[model samples]
Target: MFKGKFRIVAVICFVLFGVMAYLSSQMSFGPRDKILPGIYVLNVKLSRMDRDQAIQAMKKMEASFKQARTIQYRELSWSLPMDQVGLRLNYEEEVERAMSFGRTGSLWQQFLERREAHRSVHLKPEIHLDANLLEKTVTAAAETIILPPRDAGLIINDNDTVEISPGREGRLVDINHLQQELIKSLLTDSRSPIPLKLVVAPPVRSTEEVSAMGINRLLAMYSTQFDPNKVNRAYNVSVAAAALDGLTVAPREVMSFNEVVGPRSTEAGYKTAPIIVNNELVDGLGGGVCQVSTTLYNAVLLANLEVVERTNHSMPITYVPIGRDATVVFDAIDFKFRNNTDYWLYIQSHVKGGTLVIKIFGNEQFKKDVVIRSWIEETYNPDTLVENDYSIRMGDRLIKQKGAQGYRVSAERVVMEKGQVVKVEKLPTSVYKARNQIISQGMAPPGDILSNPELPADDSPVNGEMEEAEER
Candidate 1:
């Protein structure tokens, strides 16, 4: 009787095991159009949904993830827009992942996991980020916080001298390593600020190198003064002087004054001041900048450099001698010179104590004794012009404008080397026109009213104009 009972129990157990195996195999190899239960991705429920339905769900969630991310370096932060960084979800990859849930494991394992009241299984979505976009974003962030390495430079000191400025090492974000970190962070699906790593880069030119460039000794120096009381004129002078300061000119290089200083509009920090217009003093922009060019021209002359192109004012300016002044216009007229020496030339300029000073520094080749002289060859006397004015009393005399005398002058530069005159150069002759003086005398009879007389057309020359002027 006991043997008979054991045989019956064994037969029942075999039958139940076969049934379980068949059920597991059917679930594993059967058509799987929907996701298994207890699966979560991006905190969205995707269970019991077809592949297309799951894809639609992921698309909706992706829109919410497109938000600005913050990147931090020390205490500074930069907001990186997600759209610009090319952040998106791979719908096909994610759907394939969810669809393969019950089909991956062994038959027995799938049976156990797919059973009711089983432990929850979490899934990772296939998120895609553009590699180039990642690099560009990090680079932009680095640019904001990184101070670029600057080469050593020169500065104009208060005491009318040149000084060398030290270069500084700069820091930049390690792009390759940062990219790995960014990818890992995106995998985490966390919305926290990412920290940045930096590396040091050396400067292109060091301070010691700049100082040893044979620009130590002063070659030639010249200075001219403007009225400090005239604030606009003083400002204009300072602007031009600063633009030319600490400039380096290579050997045989030609530099134009207008090209170096640029246009002198109000946008360039020039103000209206008394400038010679039509051979008469009038308020105009960039009035006192010519004084700076004149000073530089004299310094270049003393240094024995070659004058490439130069023009003189229509009327002689009081700041410099008749033939020593150099005038410049933005696009029409220009003053240019070449660095004829073998060594490079360094220009230093400054405005202090109502004086604009320009100094040229170079090697020993430029150090020489030099003298500049100008002699008046011809002088033209001004003519007297009388006009009747109804505003003044009868027989009353008033000088409308003080006359300016014009002249032609010749200039020469003498250079001495080793106690002997080595070179003599004659500059171009300058010719100026005479401006007639105007005396307003009341010529109307008493109690006699006259119609308003039309004023004569103004013949004043425009600033930065040499149309009617000539240099021979």
Candidate 2:
């Protein structure tokens, strides 16, 4: 009876333990998992609970997530515009209240506590732009503008009565004034993209106008003196035209003859060979161009212009006097003169009937009475000759003689005022080499010398008489 009673109690205890295990397996805590009541033990499996709890938990989590997101935005609120300042502050306040409730462990926290909470969230950034404000700021900065004064009068005037007036004078526009105008225009309306127009006034004519004129006046002054056709005919097309063309001379400036002429090549139609460096004679592009420089040198001197630089030729030239010639070789050589007068000078070039002339016209105040003269310092006559004879024993027989030595000459320039010497300048010296004199061997002897001993003896007496007369 005791054994049967113990077996019945054990089976009852086993059934109770099985029922508790099945109940525990059917229980659900969140929306993703749920427990069903009275389900068979072997059939019990996990199931979706009323998502309202899970969803409610999620909703609480979402609210908590939004509060956390608001806190993050508040931290970054300083970067927002003025208009969003109040909005950002209000959102920060709501987040602070939510965090307070979360700390208290209220119903909202309980729902959130049922599941894992979201740790991160993303928020959109805002940008603000005001086109009108930008435009107003730009326009205010650009309100005031300054412009350069415009050029007003005639540049070249040909109509005249008494003296031959070349065309109107050329003028230089003030570069500073132009630059200021450009700056003002740029600052006024940066977006307008309109370029400021520069108005350069034509030259004015006053008593001072005569000096302001350039080479044009010089050319016109002497135009009537020469026949242009004849002057042109003398120059190679390239050199001649450049010579006749008016030159530009700035105030108190020096002009270079070769620099203005540039290079004379076949391309430039300069058929003659140019005088090269060190006054060495070489066949080059510009040959006869030196004539132009030489002519200008004379003109500058005649005008009483100050000579800044001038060099003589390696050899004497036929066109100008020995001391008056100016040689130029591009940058290496130059005939330069300064415009000492206060007024501008005009250079006019032209050819007239086999002559090349350059004229300089400026104020008379700067003009001076200038004169240049030169003479040979000394003359040397080295009439000595040396002879050499080689005999048949030393290969071929021959005779040789060296020629006479040449002379060295120096010259000077003198400036005069009111018949009084003001300044004197020493010119360069030149030395010529002697030529070699050679006499061939086996030449015919003089028959007169062999035929007359008395004539030879008489020749010495005659030479002696000539020498005595010279001494007396």
Candidate 3:
């Protein structure tokens, strides 16, 4: 009776094992239209979902996860725009990958993988970012945090001299490492701001290295005054001068002012100021730039350099005498000069205390005397300007401008060494056009007629220009 009972129990156990094996084999070998019972893509559970369903699920959350990325550098942070990064999610690929899981290999192996998925095996989703955009975004932000090493520079003295500025080391961001941190954070779905990694950047050129560049002494220098109260014009003067400071021109190389100075646009750090257009003071971009060119032109002449090309303004300017000024209009009209010296020509410019100064330095002794001589062959006075307005008081006179007189002037540069005339070079003939002496006569009644009061003189260069005037 006992033997019979044991056989019944053994038979029942065998039947149960057979049923389990058949079910596991069918699960491993069957056609898979849906993901396995426990599959995940980048922590998104895709259990028992079809490829389309899994794709839709990922697409729903992609927008929320792919943006709001920020990079932090201590006190500063930059939130990268989604458009700039061009972040994209490849949901279809991830869905297909999830669908294929546990679908290949031997039956036993497939069964084991399907089982492992249930306990939580994480797979990363395919994420794409525009490489160029990512690099630009990271680089732009990194620049703010990075303190780049600086080369030795110059300090112009009040007496037309120079002092060497020392170079120094600085801290710079490790762009590659920072880029990696950003990528890793995004990939790992970590939304916290990433930190910056920095490295040491040593200065390349030292004060001693700058001294060896053949800049031994000041060859010549020139200065022009301006009205600092004209805020925009004053700001523009400083901008243009900054571009010219600590510049070097090779021996015999002709340097174009426009090319060296670059474009005179708002993008190039210039502000609107008073400029000469059609013999009238008008508002235009890069107004005070001509003052910079004119100042440098005088310095070049005093240095005994060669003038390649130059043009004068339509009307005589107040900063420099007639035939002494130089006007530039970017790509159209330019003021250029050749470094006629045997050594490198180093230039230093500064705008301070309502005065703009330009100095030229080289490895040569400056001439004992350099004079800009000018003679006016013909001259004519401006016509009287009359303005009648009802708004002003009667018998009251207001002089808008003192007015400018026209002239035909010829100029030359005379260089002397040890009391002996060494060289003389003729400059372009300047022709200035006449303007009107503007007077406003009021129509409103007044008790008495008053003398026309002239406008107060200011350092603002009303005659400075940014565009070419009629070939004057």
Candidate 4:
């Protein structure tokens, strides 16, 4: 009977302990209600607090920490604001951790903790940072500290001498390393401004390298004049000349006119001007660029450079004689030459006072005296063809166009050494076809008394005047 009584008392005690533990979890606490002793969050006491009270206490502590933190760079310092860099805390996870101080574990274990309040629990809030905000901050700081390297340059003097300029080094932030430092700052609450790492950037080339190219001494030069009155044509001529300036060609390199000059279009700054099309004068784009090519062609010939490729215009141009003109049509036609010397060659071109000049420079051994010569080998006069138009008045004569004689012309390149002709190289011949004169004569009135029935003789006044300079 005594043993039975002890069992009943033990059952009652177990039931009472279960009810108290359930009530602890359900019941709310007042502002003054104390949490179990020995509970701390990041060294701040969170004991003797309810759920809401514990959260508020942590918020106040966080504010104070952020207010005192600063990131310093030299004399400049930036405040560590929770809002600016999107600093965030896992509030739910941290609060749950704090609340679990004595609430967790087996029934007996929990009861034991509450019985004496002897256990100590310490925890830190889980922190996070917005990725985009961190990236932006680091990138902005990088821009301020980064410097780009400057490449070496060339300066052409008034006397056609070239000078070299030194290049400069630059410093740039190492992004990967900077990002790593930023992560540490966010995770560890590090307030010190992180020192940035940099890499040394060297220029593409140095002054000493450019100076060793050996682009000196005038090998050959040529200049041609144009009418500045033609505004668009003159502008195109200037544009083409400017493109060829300061061009450097290595030894045995072939320089192409089309490649260097590029396309001749309105987008490329060429304007409409008179150009030869199908052996007839017509307004077209890049009209005056040919003059630039022709001028350069003569200069290259005078330099005794190897002519890799060249072609003349269909007919003679007024600026250069028949076989001397070099006509280019972008990708279709081109003028090219090779730098056959052992050293580098430089081409300098400019437009001044209505003249376009092209100068080729190389080593002294490449210099030569070159003379150009042209002569007509064969000539012929074409028969003048006449046309009749009813619009002309009766007995009134009109000459629509004057005729031009056809000729086959030959050009020679004369190379001289010490006042004696070393070689006479015959160039390609140019053939020009004659354009006939067109005459229009009006018809007489039908059966009129003023109209003479007999036609005029071959030596009549109208026919005799045309034969004054007859060759045959």
Largest TM-score belongs to which candidate?
1
Candidate 2 residues lying further than 4 Å off, grouped into runs, are 1-233, 237-244, 273-283, 379-409, 418-421, 427-472
Clash totals in order: 3, 15, 2, 2
TM-score of each: 0.64, 0.41, 0.58, 0.61
Candidate 3, 113-223: lDDT as tens digits: 777775766778766667677767766766776677898876656675667788988887665676567667866878888887778888888877777666767888899
Candidate 2, residue 65: how far the Cα is off, in Å: 62
Could you tell me the lDDT of residue 359 within candidate 2?
Answer: 62
239-346: candidate 4 lDDT, tens digit per residue: 999999989999999999999989989899888876766544557888788889889989998998888887777555666665777778887888999999888888
When 2 and 4 are scored with lDDT, the better candidate is: 4
Better of 2 and 4 by TM-score: 4
Candidate 4 Cα errors over 4 Å, as ranges: 1-150, 168-194, 394-397, 418-420, 443-472
Instruction: Estimate the TM-score for candidate 2.
Output: 0.41
Which pairs clash in the backbone of model 1? Answer: 277-461, 278-460, 278-461
Lowest summed lDDT across 10 adjacent residues in model 4 is found at: 463-472
Query: Scored by CA lDDT, what does every candidate get?
Result: 0.76, 0.43, 0.77, 0.70
**Candidate 1 lDDT by residue in tens digits, 342-431:** 777898889997888899988775689999999999999999999878755689777776576889999999989878998888988888
Model 3 score (lDDT): 0.77
